[model samples]
Target chain A: QKEVEQDPGPLSVPEGAIVSLNCTYSNSAFQYFMWYRQYSRKGPELLMYTYSSGNKEDGRFTAQVDKSSKYISLFIRDSQPSDSATYLCGKNTGNQFYFGTGTSLTVIP
Target chain B: NAGVTQTPKFRILKIGQSMTLQCTQDMNHNYMYWYRQDPGMGLKLIYYSVGAGITDKGEVPNGYNVSRSTTEDFPLRLELAAPSQTSVYFCASILAGGGIQYFGAGTRLSVL
Candidate 1:
């Protein structure tokens, strides 16, 4: 099984909608989970990261991790057109990093 | 400061041609990595270096070579390019004990 798995979603949502992106991992050893946002033709940038579990919030974005289920999620409170990009979820074992297939999202105006 | 920089923002290569994707970081990071992103596939690791003079293969390392002569630079060399090698390449790095990865602007390569 792949280390990380995510839905390759072209999820379309209206502006101000709540957006939820999720990922699951097979490696129980994975601890640090991260979410990245990538615009077209640009590189992925770190959006949020969580060390073990629980939730971390920054502005309109919140990252949640459940080590027990090996699941990670990113929730956007109020989606915006600027949030239209590919979201990638990943986990790092300090040395090696594994990323998911990414979910493409478009916030309609 | 330029956190991480990749050269040749875009390139086109003929089959069997060779090229190198350059990656440099100014953050003095000890860990550097090379990854390839495909259409529906996420970023796949090609190569990574824990520190200067130490390199290791990641998930996808075929048809590629890498060398880390210094902590500031890590370049990936494609000895013989193929159509399967056409993809967007990204270089990333993080501090020795940090979990966050800083990525370059990326290099888009097309093999014809």
Candidate 2:
């Protein structure tokens, strides 16, 4: 099984809607969870990260991690067209990092 | 600070060709990594270095080599590029105790 698993979503939602992107991991050793946003033809950029199991809020985005279930989530509020991009969930096991296939989100305006 | 910079934004090479993808960071990060991203495959780590002169293989290390002679530079060498190697390559770095992993703009490579 892949270390990290995420839905390859081409999820489309209307503007001002709430969006939730999720990922699950098989490795319990992963202590750090991260969310990255990538635009077309560009590299992924760090959006937010949380250590262990907890919730972190950054403006309109919130990152939640449940270490017990090895699940991670990113919530976007008031989604806008500019929020349309691919979101990737990543897990870090100290020296190495693993990423999911990413979920493609498009906020229709 | 130029966070992370990668060279040869785009390249097309015939099978069996060899090339080096350069990555440099001005942040002086202690850890550097090389990853390849194919459509729907996400990012597959190729190699990583904890610090200068120390390199280790990641999940996908075949056909690739890396060196870290300085804290600011980590370059990936692709020898005998295969058609399967065609993908977008990304270089990333982070500080010693762990924090954010800054990524470069990525190199789009096509091996035909």
Q: What is the i-RMS of every prediction?
A: 1.1, 1.0
Question: What is candidate 2's CA lDDT for residue A25?
Answer: 92
Q: Candidate 2 residues A1-109, lDDT tens each?
A: 9989998998999999999999999967636789999999998999998786788999999999888888899999999999999999998887999899999999999
- Model 2 chain A lDDT-worst window of ten: A25-34
lDDT of 1: 0.94
Q: Score the docking of each candidate (DockQ).
A: 0.81, 0.83
Q: Candidate 2 lDDT, tens digit per residue, B1-112?
A: 6799999999999999999999999998999999999999999999999999999999999999999999999999999999999999999999974578999999999999
TM-score of every model versus the real structure: 0.98, 0.97
Candidate 1 clash pair list:
none
For each model, chain A TM-score?
A: 0.97, 0.96
Grade the docking of candidate 2. Answer: high
**Residue A31 in candidate 2 has what lDDT?**
66
Q: Going through the candidates in order, what fraction of the true interface contacts does each contain? A: 0.81, 0.81
A1-109: candidate 1 lDDT, tens digit per residue: 9999998888999999999999999978636889999999999999998886899999999999988888899999989999999999998886889999999999999
**Residue pair clashes in candidate 2:** none
